[model samples]
Target: MGILANTVSFRQYQVLGDPPAGDPGEWAGPLLAKNAFVPIDSGSEEISSGWVCLDDPQNGSFAERRDFFRPPSLAFTLRRDQRRVPAALLRRHLQKAEEEFLAAHPGLHRVPKDKREELRDTVKGALLARTLPTPSFFDAVWDLERGLLTFTGTSPNIAEIFEGLFRQTFEGLRLVVLHPFARARALLPAKLQPLLEEQNRAATDAVLEQIQENTWLGADFLHWLLAHSVAGRNSFRVRRAGPALMDEAFVAFLDNRLVLAAGPQRVTVAGPQDHYSEARIALDAGKEIAEAGIFMEKGEDAWKTTLKAETFLFGSFKAPGVKPEKDGITDEKSEREAIFYERMHVLAEGLQLFDSLLLAFLEERLAADWPKRREQLQRLLGFEEQ
Candidate 1:
């Protein structure tokens, strides 16, 4: 009971700042249209918003409810570093300020000014011990590496709220899910392939070709996705539940592999494009790291983790040093720096291409399926004139 009470007081403390002020949602465009969503009054004009909805009946299929794939918003306060504020100095400053104010105010108070000044000083110091909790939301910012959003909460969900927000304002924009299994697998070492053979063997090109015929129109592509997973394992029982096959949990296993393969490395940062930005080193002497970042994205201001996706798309390194067989005139430091910079550019380019691939995959799938899905929805809504 005590634990539950403390928990409720948490995000509960943030309700005031989480939602936007008033009804700016009137003019709101589709949530997915602009990278940053802004709500405004649209009046009688038709407007659409983008929303991600889960149709699972087990997880509340009722109208206007939704579990959040990301945190909607957050709230906290910011104050100065209390340790930096000296108690004696602050006391004296407060003492002077109060005396000045009282002298200026003249006939306002019958209370002894000295005692009142001391009380005010004590109260001021307590407040200034710098409580800097930011009631701020990192909503909509996706952590590309982790495949999750920042500032999310525990199990109690808001799926309906997400759906309602979408239906009311973003009736046309699209929401998408990106699977990075294939890309992550490709990044693994050749020696580790055997362990994931069950999954890889299924997603192979040959099996994918066979899946084309089984692909059903107007159905969620989830069926095709499952089939593809089996194409890698070569077999899976239909009766099997949850993630019916090895590949069904692609993101989970891939993330695990990334953690292992991204073992200790001499990570070198090379570009001045963000030279001023702090570079990151994974596998620190003491750290739990499946990923790392080159800027503050991994730290205090991580509203931009996905934004760094393009800057650091693919992460790996080749054998270090000039080949031992024939390397003569080498100022090693200079050589290392040059190589590092070259590597940085190559990484940036790869990230750009990878991001493009993710975008392309979603574009093709949405265009091909959404039209038919819309028809089905209309029929369900009785627009089919049955």
Candidate 2:
């Protein structure tokens, strides 16, 4: 099954190796069960079987692990469960009961610490036995032919567990997290390679500084683009090394909605009608973009995705204009291989566009330019200066 937009966030991995021989329908279940989680009956933490078919073939039955083979790809759900007793609540109840016991037996002195600890354990055990487990679900798709696996998840812990489980389930397959650094390392030009490689050699926050530098550029570029779009200016030009000129395309329009968060708790979201003004208000109120649904056409293909500003992560990418073709393909394997590589190439291009736009923003605009531009945006949107 393919990743569905709106609900899940995902990261792509370059799966390495040919598809395992034998019918996936027959061996998939055995592989999944090999590393499946076992739920403890009465423990504070219990992890359930994390691997299962995404769509249950049988109604209310897990025998549907056989349904994982959906032609060229295998899709499944990774789930984990955690059960815990609230320590504070249990302790509070134990303390109240201890006080009652002391009051009843006024002849006895203070209860021994060891006996009190015993009571505490009893209370904790009772609570643990009664509490229900919290469950987490993630979607995973394994493209058998192209050696590409896309995990529909975002959390690092879940990702770690997923990687371990995946390796255990399918021996020799390793998942390299395609984080920004990893992507940059894989795709950045040779000249800038040293900057990334030597970033962490000296422990002066260089690696983090590099990341922040890029992140700031990305945010400022988005901010600058929004300002220019509001003012009806879209074209941009970049000066490359020597006399060469590089065409810069960072045009993006706010799509359906914008999501902004002031801090950890407050989020102000608005839809398309007067969305720019809503965004200005949120910005003026000291909010950072949590997610911005944007439509961007930088070069060959237009991209529609929700951009998470904090991490510069794109989600639910819609690349309709760039479709892979299998024009001369005769066999199913060849066709699948062509489509997979094409999709990967398009994704790589999108990432390259992202890097180029941020570089352009940093080079073409200075830090001193932001305040004036920000004021102009606020004034245009009719928001009072803070």
- List lDDT for all candidates, in order: 0.28, 0.59
How many clashes does each candidate structure show, in the order listed?
31, 0
**Consecutive 10-residue window with the lowest summed lDDT within model 2:** 236-245
Best by TM-score: 2
TM-scores across all candidates?
A: 0.21, 0.56
Q: Pick the candidate with the highest lDDT.
A: 2
Q: Could you tell me how far off, in angstroms, the CA of residue 129 lies in candidate 1 after the best superposition?
A: 20
RMSD per model, one decimal:
23.7, 9.0
Report lDDT (Cα) of residue 180, candidate 1: 37
Deviating ranges (above 4 Å) for candidate 2: 1-6, 13-29, 40-49, 57-66, 84-89, 96-117, 144-148, 167-174, 184-213, 224-252, 256-291, 296-305, 314-386
Model 2 lDDT tens row, 1-386: 23433223567676755556887777776777565555555565434546755543111223453356665677677867777667689878898868877888898788678878987777777776778877667767776765657786777677788888888788877776544445445544576666555433323424345444455434555665565555656544432321113565446565666676755755646565453776766777776656777665655556676776655556776653434364664665445445544554455445445555545454334434656766775566566557
Per-residue lDDT of model 1, residues 1-386, tens digit only: 01011111111110111222343222222232232222222222122222222212122112221222212211111111112345686677667766776687798664376767666756565544442322111113222223322112212233233324433433443222222333333433465445334333234444233233222211222212222222332221221122122122111001111121123543333333221122212212221222222111111211112111211222221111222222667765445334433432333332333233233333334454656654553343233322
Off by over 4 Å in 1: 1-92, 96-336, 365-368, 371-386
